[model samples]
Target: MDWEYFFELLLGGLTRGSIYALIALGYTMVYGIIELINFAHGEIYMIGAFTALIAANVLTMLGMNELAVLVLASVVAILYSAAYGFTVEKIAYKPLRQAPRLSPLISAIGMSIFLQNYVLLAQTSDFLPFPSLIPELEFMEPIAHIISSAEVIIILTTAVVMILLTLLIKYTRIGKAMRATAQDRSMAMLVGVNVNRVISTTFVIGSALAAVGGVLIASHIGMINFYIGFIAGIKAFTAAVLGGIGSIPGAVLGGMVLGWTESFATGYVSSDYEDVFAFALLVIILIFRPAGILGRSTTQKV
Candidate 1:
């Protein structure tokens, strides 16, 4: 294998990893704050892509340039997705909070299917092409030939958002409430944290991040379908599990690792086997460290 080819593959892997990291953050945050699986989170991602697509089209009709359209579309898509997420939590999850865990899980799955079919019914089952907002520019020198605009945008955008999230979780008052709730819901409530508000806020933030991921991935690939989230969701969930479901930083690490693994598998092995490789890695990791890379084992008191 040529060294240059290897470097290219690595770069591609990093770019894909960044996308996975963003999506995984959503999964990790929701899972951390509430033990629910939120199976519909992936469907939220799919909706976000469509939302961006519609927003971009509207912007285009309004005569906005590519850059402006991208910005508008992103803002609109994120807001819509966040609203949808908050609503889903309120309607589908909140009421089930005190109910059986299986009930919530089932509702999540139902929501996922409903969103998918809703999209399919509204839009044809055919894959619709999403207009490219970002130019596909190469930034590196001839010999290096290292980067693509998509990769740069994905890395820089995700880095900025991650930094902001870190700050928000560390410094903000609501962030404190969220952390407190995550630590002990009943205790946090006793301490005056509005558990409902915190949960809704968590869902909003996660959904917004997933919306960003949806836009990025759709822009990168240039086409989308209702089912796009299914595989990505599984991979992201795997990343969250790999890194430690409740750990934010762990999700980032897990996403990057999963992305690179898929890239290498596609480059060296077969693209067809990429999905298989991801699950295999997950299985291997579980076999060695059941709790996950950053997950801690806790003792139960009887």
Candidate 2:
């Protein structure tokens, strides 16, 4: 067995899983709070990448350092994405809060389609080059054969983000409110929790995370286009469902499992059927464990 080759695939899978977890975090969080899938979440991620690209270009023309440009561009993307998230919730979801579940769902899909078309017309269909934010460090030049600096950063960042998010949802006041809202929206409101604010906050947090994923992924891949969101979003959504749609830890676990599945398949078998293996694993898991790896089975008394 080629040990070096095996490690390379392992790290590659970790990187892929980390990025998927970043985006999946958004899907799971929003669903945890509002029980909505938020299909438009993916478009928010695409917008973030585009926003970062535009910001980086402008900053480079201003002769900023690489670090400064990356930081500023990512900030711009996150804030802009948050604004869009807020708008999406208000426009596409808030009005239909009391309506049938399908109402908001259809609205979410429509919003996703509208944003994709909007960006297509506004930006060229061709893939545009993205700036590399994570530069190769000199220290890692020796290990470059096994892993890249960007992959390391991606894995580390995802881990840190997951830890921080876990803390936020566990200890903070907003987190407590979110949990309450998720458990019982009507009871939360009765207890003076601003359900609207919690829901909006959920969207904002999810969008910001998605934006981070977008910027990092664009930098890693070195190019992106308007349609990138749909593919990434679908994979992330699958990760969420596979992990247990409403569970945060489950999302990350699901992403990692899916990532490793694809990577090992590509390494040992063929890249042609990479996605097939990933989805097949998901299907098998769902068949036996419908609640997901870390997900709890909840029975509504309704």
- TM-score of every candidate relative to the true structure: 0.94, 0.98
Model 2 per-residue lDDT tens digits across residues 230-291: 99999999999999998988889988988889999999999999999999999999999998
Alpha carbon lDDT of each predicted model = 0.88, 0.93
CA lDDT for candidate 2: 0.93
Top candidate when judged by lDDT against the true structure? 2
- Candidate 1 local lDDT, 170-257, one digit each (tens): 8999999988998889999998999999999999999999999999889988999989988788888888999888778888888888
Candidate 1 weakest ten by summed lDDT: 136-145
Tell me the lDDT of model 1 at 29: 91
